[model samples]
Target: MIPAIGWLLSSFLVAWLSARAAIAYAHRRGMLDRPGQRRSHSIPTPRGGGVGIVVASLLCLPGVLLGTAEPWPPRVLIGLLVALLLVALAGWWDDHRSLPILPRFGAQLLAVLLFAVASGVAGLSWWWLPVLVLGGAWSINLHNFMDGIDGLLAQQAMFVGTGLALLAWGGGQEALALAAGCLAAASLGFWCLNRSPARIFMGDVGSGSVGLLIFAFTVMLGRAGAWLLWPALILSSAFVVDASLTLLSRFWRGRRWYTAHREHLYQWLVRCGLTHAGGGVIYMTWNLLFAAPLAWLAWSHPRQALPTTMGAYLAAAALWLLLKRRCLRRRSNKDRHVAA
Candidate 1:
């Protein structure tokens, strides 16, 4: 417990200072994002705020190695670290150079394979493999896609890390809990800078790293015998719904799935005249409303009932999306007319 607190404090300090420095560095380097068509922000904001994410995560590694997590086998940790490094490099490259989508997505695939192999994904039932792979792919891209607004990715990370840590505590994986605590703490500090009307943006590095970490954590927890998968999905349902639905919609319309666009649910909300803060609040609300009760049910019900609870959430998300999209279209038309 004390170790977790120590890590939390250190991670926050490092991430905060790093973000402040990145703003200046990007500004000096002429790396800011200027507003234009298909953009949300108005000013040329200094970007590449993922600097904090990389710095904070690297700082946490030493503590994880030095702490009680020692028994978790060095190779697995090293492999995971290598994957993160690859993603970080890819992210930085994307930030500076704007690498094509295929290459970036390729690196993410490699990371997913690395995590799967590292944690013995073979041990899981066959049914979960395709879902796990899809989930990993989903998690990575979803985070990147949802990074449109400031603080959204970091805020999502906070809730996710907190949820994983809770399940870790319940499942007696103390070391993992400590690691999650460090991440959650860093995310909070980063969120201060990332919040709407943000001082800095997360860029690709923060978003990719976040998705990678969450996916990895899920695998690790599943291996540790925690059956609380329902709650975990609930915690992340907002982003999942938006990204998946948007991608499917694009595919149905014969649009390329790999291209960047502004048709995401949150983007639609913004198009409908909701401020970024308003969208963030609504986005987070679903997580609390869905995850809280689902988490309780995950802990309370017998193992056999897990499927039923999870199914209910799937149905609910589907229904919510249908209604929400209709609402957005109506308001968005009005907004467009006003602008016209």
Candidate 2:
């Protein structure tokens, strides 16, 4: 217990210090995200502070290998590191200057392939490969889409990481628990600088890497116990629902779904007059009041895990549609008032 606590504290401090350095570096490099038509913030802010979280998470690898008695191979550890670096490096490049979609996607796919290879996903047979590749790619991009406002992705990462950590611990998976705990702690450190009225944005460097970490955590948790994946999805319901629904709606309406836009439910919350912090709180509230309880129920009743997950997602989808419609109506009413 003491060692675990120490690891978490170290992760937090490393990320905190890294975030400070990233702030200075972003300023020096002129990597600022300026306000624009589809942007959430009203002022220009330095970006790529997510590098702090990435650094902190990468540092946890040695701790996990050394501290646990889990007999993982050195090759696997090295592969994981290489995979993380590939994604982080790609995102770091994009942070400095936008990359064309094809190149960005190529990097993400290669990282996913590396992750699968390192984890011995091929041993499960070739079929799982394509599914995971697609899922991993979606996980990477959905996070980038959802990271439009201050502290939102950080908050979600902390919540999901902590949730998975506890679940892994309960299932007697010490390595997975430690890894997930480190992610939560690192996110908490970045959150200090990332809260509303932000000091620095996470940029692509942080958001995409965090997404990959969460995906990795979920896969490990599922490996420990297949039933646990249901709860993992439950914990991630807020982001998944918002992003998936928004994308589907855009596609259904024949909009360019691949382009950046202020159409996410969270973005609409900001457009509806809530502060970035307020939108974050709303999402966090659902995690706590809705997702958390259902996750606990799923954990306690393994037999019902799948059903509980399905029900939770159903409710979340309903709420998302209702809230999104309300936001649209409010915008329409406000527009009428302005015209009158």
Identify the candidate with maximal lDDT: 2
TM per candidate: 0.91, 0.97
Give the clash total for candidate 2.
0
Give candidate 2 regions above 4 Å deviation.
121-125
List the RMSD of every prediction in angstroms: 2.6, 1.4
Which candidate number would show the highest TM-score if scored against the true structure?
2
> How many clashes would you count in candidate 1?
0
49-74 in candidate 1: lDDT tens per residue? Answer: 87786788787865674468434656
Superposed Cα deviation of residue 148, candidate 2 (Å): 1.1
